[model samples]
Target chain A: MVTINKPATKLNEPSKPQKSSSPSLTAFVKAFKNSIVLIVFILLWELAPQLGFVEKTFLPPFSEVVQAWWELLVTGELWRHFEASILRSLFGFLLALALAIPLGLIIGWYPLARDLLTPILELFRNTAALALLPVFILILGIGEVSKISIVLFACTWPVLLNTISAVKNVDPLLIKSARSMNISSFKLFYKVILPASVPTIFTGIRMAGTGAILVLIAAEMIGAKAGLGYFITYSQYNFLIPEMYAGIITISLLGLLINYGLSSAERYFSRWKQ
Target chain B: MDKIKFERVTKKFLVRDEYKKGAQREFTAIKDIEFSVKEGEFITLVGPSGCGKSTLLDLLTGLTQPTKGRILIDGREITGPGLDRGIVFQQYALFPWKTARGNIEFGLEAKGIPKSERKEKAEYYLDLVGLKNFADRYPHELSGGMKQRVAIARSLAFNPDVLLMDEPFAALDAQTRETLQTELLRIWKKTGKTIIFITHGIDEAVYLGERVVVLSANPGTVKKIVDIPLKDRLEDADIKSNPAFINARREVWNLLHEPEFQGAHI
Candidate 1:
């Protein structure tokens, strides 16, 4: 056996076992340092109304919003609306994914499909999803279908266009290499093309997820009985400012949670990239 | 019988001339090329940059069609890429997503080898390349030499009759190149598979090949074929400084600098 001696460098050395508990303490302190700006912002928000910089009835202090959020949580009313919104967004997003991915692959792979569908796609992609809300309500009768269709419309373009571009732009060298191996065309697509296009596809899926939430909330606000969007709008009309703030905060938190979930999935799928 | 035969093979490409729009020009990459490689022979094709060395390999692999004439392996015409020949590209075209063993198992998987057998074969080849411990490491995690080694292991794992290498060591440092050259000779001797290595380096061609086929540039054609007769050169550490090795190197160098070969140099 030939023994090839590599250079001695700390970079390649395996990590040593930690003998002290001090490192975890230091890491906790470092995390706090990173979040210092957010902490200060929350503190300033809490003090602004108490200092009379704004009227409490109009803007309400951060603490009052939290209290309203807690009361809603205790009564379990928020959970119902949250579950409804989550289900609508997820169902629409998944449906869009199922339709868009296969169509995108087809359009990207064959020039005939691209030539026939490109102009139509461009036209629909340019039109805003919210602009179609009234048309969808007219066509689908303002029920769950209209709301779901709005989310689907908003989410589809990004996922479809990105998948098309990803499939079209796979490295020619990779295809050449695989072809030289005498692999079948079907095997080439599944083994080489799909894996290679995954990172870019994930980018599109994450964008579609964000788009689904935004369109769903806007759709929910229009003639809806139960949703975070309806709750915020209804509370504002009833002069329950703290409840309105709580609803807005909930929506923001929901967006953050969706983003975190998508990013984690992206990381798991693309672990080989690093 | 010769393992590979090229009978009056010619290749032409249609290229758009940059200076004149709407005019397509026919550029001859190689013309009337005739050569044959014996089974288990180590042959090197050496030339200047645009001498169609890579195009020749492409034709051999059946990746591209010859404009005229035909190439035969074991007296049968090569229609397209098949399992009989394997190739190692300069870029090391390993799938970045796969680990070392996974990349090596790619061809076997294509052949419908079962998972257990594929794993065993992949491990065997990885060990042959001296990367047994690196089986689980991805391409990005390996160094340049390690990556090339993995690529070599991958090609060899498929057990093809002929191995076509296109300047496979040109990107490495001098030290690593020398090490790999020796390792390749060892592998070639062990496996006894026909190897057709393409390179521009005169010394590298002489060091590894039994016979070096030198091609002239404009419309690439064989200029000369020089035989290096040192039988046990790979066993010598200082073969480069040996007298016969120097004389063969000088001979090939003189052929490349001939007046007819001068204008092709940029």
Candidate 2:
């Protein structure tokens, strides 16, 4: 009965864990290693055309795109197109906001109305704003109205849905608490529910702003005569690849700028929340 | 005249959907409950949690319509919630977007107090609740105790005829709860306002009430009403260690623990 198991291995042997002093540093090193592919991509783009690996006529180098950007800047044509696109986007976006906000508030506050209209709105929201391009072109004849309609369709959903959910998601406790204080009905909505939902509402506006700009450019590209989208299509057709690429760059920059502006607005309004 | 009265109030509830319309089961929430509060009285409704002390308060505040009876406040029938009765909820329900001063001035502004007078009233209560430095801070920025204090200040700013509170300090930590209770007493004294406080906490009921009314489990009904007359003796801190405090808590505890409270969730 005194049979004792001998040491299967070194009983007190300390198993060492792999040394990792800083996981964050390791992650940074790993990311840098992974970015080598991107570096190679840039290098290939820079060197391929110069080495005649591809036809220079069809595809200009990045340098040529930059040079085209400089020429456009000097002539102020770039700024003009940029201004036109921004103005259309702004007008359409504001118009849609004015329409959607009150409508959405009414639907959200009344359960019966929301239930009645939910299916119809679902159908319209699912129909792509771009798909209405042909209908808009026929009715508005490719003028400001057509372009504005496209932008308006793209921006409406985010603001509307956000408003509805913002109203719907107000805490029951807040309502009960307010009623106990004898707050008037109008006061309850403005003072309690609206303020409670401001953060979520801002999220919607930011999304709508970005979406309107993105869709506006796409619409403009298809039918516009003078905006940046129009200029890109014209340059591409006329064998001006560098200017075409320059237009692409400008579109991305405009999107980034709009996103930055809306984000700042959200932060400003919600500063007190945190 | 009584400040508030509920004459033979009976509340019923449907137990099931009964969509067939012909058949349904109804449960009694409270049956023939009758009580009243006097002017300048501090009445604490103490019972096991489901005893409908809060429902009674809601009736007095006109937030609910009694199914079979009537409620009178200052001999007038209660129709709906009005500015005359101010309530503090279990959760400190301050407006999150506004600063402490803004919340305090809210009622007065609605009642058309001038800008200077509003500022004066807000500042006065801010000082009373010891939140003068926190005047510009929003509710989200303040601690739980501070928010509750601001709520009290806002409620008192209107000089409500009756103060109705439903477990106002239940959400606070023990220290904060005790502090608020004492503050409430101080405010009650300074303003001479009638207070109807509801609680399941036996110790708090004894400490805060001029009279403690106890109720049995559902179908809730009043079982005992103990008139403390202990306010004079409770002036000192060490007075809590006196026999009366323990005796009151024990009496309420005894009334609450009768076989019904063992199964109730509250």
Candidate 3:
């Protein structure tokens, strides 16, 4: 009983009168227990180079990487790269979302639209975004347009496909029930279909979020004056290994933040799903 | 005058023949389904599994058009579903995203009722179905019986004169089914709304309806319409235990079991 209460205390406020102080203590212990593996991995990362398990130049200690990250942060160099990547991914992801959702809804709702577009969609969906980067660079040039377009291309498929399936898969009984009240087609779509498809559409959006980050990183690595991907490549060229690790760490943290944001949004939208 | 009428309604479906590749066959679900309901009357439809009981309700709701003949409501032809009628399906059909009150407000909103009036009417029906306390609860948060109650409140909220229910309590346990039956009768008396309920349960048909319309299968059509005359209905006696109730149940049972209909035990 106490063990069950301990895990739940992590979520709930400290309101129980039986052991107010113990709840916090239990929460801390639970959190510690959960992250013990992560703590050990971090410890090993810090110690391996110092203990001569690996060469210092190849893999610096975790502290040295953290120090490098702080130095880059203070110099404001990291922020410039971070800002460039953030803007590109954000614009690309938003564009894909704006275009894909409406198109997907139409295609899913109307069989004629689905039949007309599905063949073309499937042809492009199978073509990798990275493979099209060179063509995009040649057509759009090695500018912000090209980098953003690559992210847009990669992100579009997940959102579009997921949205299409989401709309198509809404329970037919819901539609029947709504229509029985003489609801208009527009009302049926907005009131019934849209809300019913939310959770599935969110699944697509999250996948697109991840794709936006990864594809933008790859595009930046290919050609960019400033961005986290470019910074890492530049650091590698100059043998600034710690700084390279720092850029990699920044990308990882950014991915975590985006994933965390999407999951929270999904939770809020689907709160009724038990 | 009859509140609702079904004039020689026949529904047909085209299906691919299982044995013959790419071949289509015509199947008749119900033939010449003719009936009439007086204003404020309560009627129950009972039939075996393939008797097109659900198909009949769908036609009445205007979810589907009859292949032949037509349905009428208030002496006007029903070209499509209108606010004059409401339907309750076997599944609660409450929107998971909407709370009990929100679901009740849906049809009213569609009917262009003002927000305040919609809220008032939703509250009234929520209270009518004994789900006032659960007005804020989502469909998934409610129990099976509670969800069905919310569904009833939602349909009733729009003030439709005719309510068509397709086995609305078929999914509940016997206790909840009986309880909802009593509640339904009480609401019918209070609101004076005409109801056409479809069910497989003979006891349920006898208990709920003023008249039970028993149907035969294999191209479904009406077989018998049994009138139930109870001296003490729900208010004064255990109606199910009454002799009239037993006799009505047995009569419907005998009609369904007359060797022509298949799966009559259902």
lDDT of 2 by residue, A1-274 (tens): 2333433452224555536556566566778899989788767776788789997777677788789998998999999898999999999888888988778877888999888877878777778888888888998988998999888887888888888878888887778767766778898888787777888878878888987877887788888878888888888889788898889889889888888988888888787776
- Model 1 Cα lDDT, one tens digit per residue, A89-147: 98899999999988898898887887788788888878889999999999998788888
Write the residue-wise lDDT of candidate 3 on A1-274 in tens digits.
3434433452214546665456666777878999999999999999999999999998999999999999999999999999999999999999999999998998899978887887888778788889999999999998999998988898888888888889989999999999998989998999999999999999999999998998899999999999999999999999999999999999999999999999999999998787
Residue A33 lDDT, candidate 2, scale 0-100: 99
Model 2 bad stretches (over 4 Å): A1-63, A181-183, B18-25, B232-234
Query: Which residue pairs clash in candidate 1?
Result: none
| Top-down TM-score ranking | 3, 1, 2
**Per-residue lDDT over B1-266 for candidate 2, one digit per residue giving the tens place of the 0 to 100 score:** 79988798887767765676666677777778888889999989887766777678777778788888888888999988878888887887777778999988886765567988999999999999999999998888788999999988988887788998889999899999988888889888888999989888888888889889888768778888887757553378775777877788778888788776788765
DockQ of each: 0.75, 0.25, 0.64
In terms of docking quality, model 2 is acceptable
Ranking by DockQ: 1, 3, 2
lDDT of 1 by residue, B1-266 (tens): 79999999999999998879999899999999999999999999999878899899999989899999999999999999987898898989999899998899998887678888999999998988899999998888888899999999888988999999999999999999988999999999999999999999999999999999999987999988999987896778899899999999999999999888777872
lDDT per residue for candidate 3 within B1-266, as digits (tens), equals 99988899999999899989999999899999998999999999999888898788888888789999998898888888888888898998889999889999998997889998998999899899998788888888788899999889888888899898989998999889888988999899999999999998898898888999999987889988999997557675577778888888889989988878645545
TM-score of each: 0.94, 0.86, 0.95
Better of 2 and 3 by TM-score: 3
User: Cα lDDT for residue B151, model 2?
Assistant: 89
